[model samples]
Target: MASKPMNVVVIGGSLGGLMHGIVLKRLGHTVRILERNPSPLLHNQGAGVVAGNDTQDFFQHHDLTHRSLAVTSHLRHYLDVKGNEIHREEYAQQMTSWDLLYYVLRANFDRVESGYCTLPPVQDGEGKATYQYGHTVTALRDLGPDAGVELSFRDRDGESGKRTADLVIAADGGSSTVRKLLQPDVERKYVGYVAWRGTVPERSLSAAATAALAEKFTFFHASGVQVLAYLIPVPDGALEPGKRLMNWVWYVNYAPGSAAYRELMTDVDGKAHAVTLPAGKMAPRVWHKQKAVAAAALPPQFADIVAKTEQPFIQAITDVLSPCNTYLDGRVLLVGDALAGFRPHTAASTSQAAYDALMLDAMLRGEMSRQEWAARTMEYARRVQRRGVEMGERSQFGRHPYAGTYPG
Candidate 1:
């Protein structure tokens, strides 16, 4: 136990929020997480994720199982305009689903087997952390370093209340309400493109399709369009071959103010969505149009995956980087996508969250001063954010440096 256990409130109870809660609680802080959704907030049905070093290190440090949590691919193949593989390289990527990693972090924090991870929580959380679903954090403010911070929240039924915490961690996501409150002028810049993502069960595709796509991070790029696909565990984290899902992401450039952009964002309810069209929400005509476009642009291998998928979704690629992450004399800190939203090309957002948690823990443990903590974390965010943008531009423009290289 610490000399003083600060009351910590984490906004947005997805990956980032849960990660911060686990790390803070591990250091003897009393934690309360506020999530807006009544049910589990599935950001997407599932996202194909690449677990980099920061992620694996976090799991190891926390005693969580990381190996069996993901589907792995030993090689990557690049396809030509036709479906023939023109480039083959050894590319080992441990690809996990968003749900799997989220639940693993949850299980570790609660010290229970959440059915997502075989490893039970190694740390004790008798009364240290509490997760409150259906609670919306409407407002919060720093009352000075001495007075800590005050937060106002509203539940699903319209009841609203206030509470005080010695520290506040806004791990809210890219479209973060807390972040807007702090820096309203920092808008999310639309990158004039969209990604259509979907997953097909291994059993649904033909044997030829399986052989072409199975066990590899396959990619196709041509004329400013890119498609990447790989296998991922089933919804329940089942890694059996037939039980896994083949996840695909097709990136297409779309002008922000074009008529096509407006039509693509119209949901089934006839409402225009700004960012993401979730699974089962896109209008029938819109999705049909997307599939037709995929057929015309992508190679037949990827076109087949799109045609077979039951629920394909689209997200307008956007960028947001805050000038500063720390505020109110360090009583309030922004973490994860809330602090800086990155392009998904590098799949570095979750890794950044994991790094933030570890670094914040170190700071709380008195390893660095306030200024040093802020400078280092902000620097990391800037560097990774820049790298992600570079990769995104390259992939979006069909100009990858590794276009013809086969490392193996």
Candidate 2:
């Protein structure tokens, strides 16, 4: 006789959610993803992401093949404000665009037509799973000592409903509703700086400018700010000739609750902006000032890359820790950034998510009891989160005088 399938509900259809769903589905468990967004196509934003060797293994373990990976430019050099090359090292691995990764993963999920709020059964077997979009989980209830837990959600049409599952996985991102419901006491803290990111077409730059920024990855470090630029390939070679895009990010320190903070956080129309920094809205004058700062401070090669940028965007950095206690009343599980969001310094955000998926897969496979799984998973999360924090603390490049400098 075959064993019974586990009914699993994964909240947040982002990278982590999808990853978990795919792995669980492969393991013969019924999986469903609940996403608040209306559809997956709404996400058009893209960013360059660096994945290390560990990440490569994580991808392969989840059945992500080489064909699914995006071709990214490798890291080449780090330069100081005066155009002098400070450090040069060859990156062992490559980088890729976030959109490419998402697209590949979504295709791998193989149920894109079904929305996350609908909860329509996509896979049929002894174990069936589904994803329901526009379903905002409002509350969770502990169903007695023996029964499984219950989840309450607001559907797309604002109708409220409840469902019970053997396991609940919260991969819902930094602002996870499941996390809030499970661990209401945990708080999110803002880091001391904001990140400005944008992409420019290679054709928009002169030949010399293009040559200067054609590297895989490059960083420009100055006194109070640092800029990073990298190359990304676009489709349509020669005939349509899509320009190679240069993705750049600028990190500037800003005091919390200050006028400059307000100004920097405000949109071009003077309205408060949230989440991502708006593209093409910043004033040309402000950009010119930034360019001037780059020109005056950054090394010649790095400054040239910044000067070639079309429109630079900004985003405030924030960090959040998972609740100190694991197991929500001994039922729900929180994973990935939904538990502990780190500063983007270590480039481990995606890697950590991959780790969570693998670990959860192992635990759900009956390698350990539910309580033991929770303890071990939480320990792994804590260790990863601690690493992220350490990297973030050390990432104070502009604020610290000795940052990016090597002692002879």
How do the residues 23-116 of candidate 2 rate in per-residue lDDT, one tens digit apiece? 7787787788888887644364446676655556667775433354544555577665554566777764456556555655665565443221
Candidate 1, 1-408: lDDT as tens digits: 124888989998988888889888788788999888886544556677888888877777864565477778889898865677888999798888898887777776655456666766455543387888888888887787677899998987889989898888898889988888888999988897888899999888877668889889998876567788999988778998889999999888888889889888888998888888888988999888777876766667777898999988888898999999987777789999999999888788989888998888778788877788788889989998898888788877657643432211
- Considering every candidate listed, which one attains the maximal lDDT? 1
Clashing pairs in 1: none
lDDT of 1 at 258: 95
Candidates in order have lDDT scores of 0.81, 0.66
Q: Which runs in model 1 stand beyond 4 Å of their true positions?
A: 1-3, 40-43, 63-67, 111-114, 118-127, 401-408
Q: What shift in Å separates residue 118 of candidate 2 from its native position after superposition? A: 24
TM-scores for all candidates?
0.93, 0.83
User: In model 2, where do residues sit more than 4 Å from their true spots?
Assistant: 1-3, 42-44, 64-68, 72-76, 113-129, 202-215, 233-244, 280-292, 304-311, 368-376, 397-408
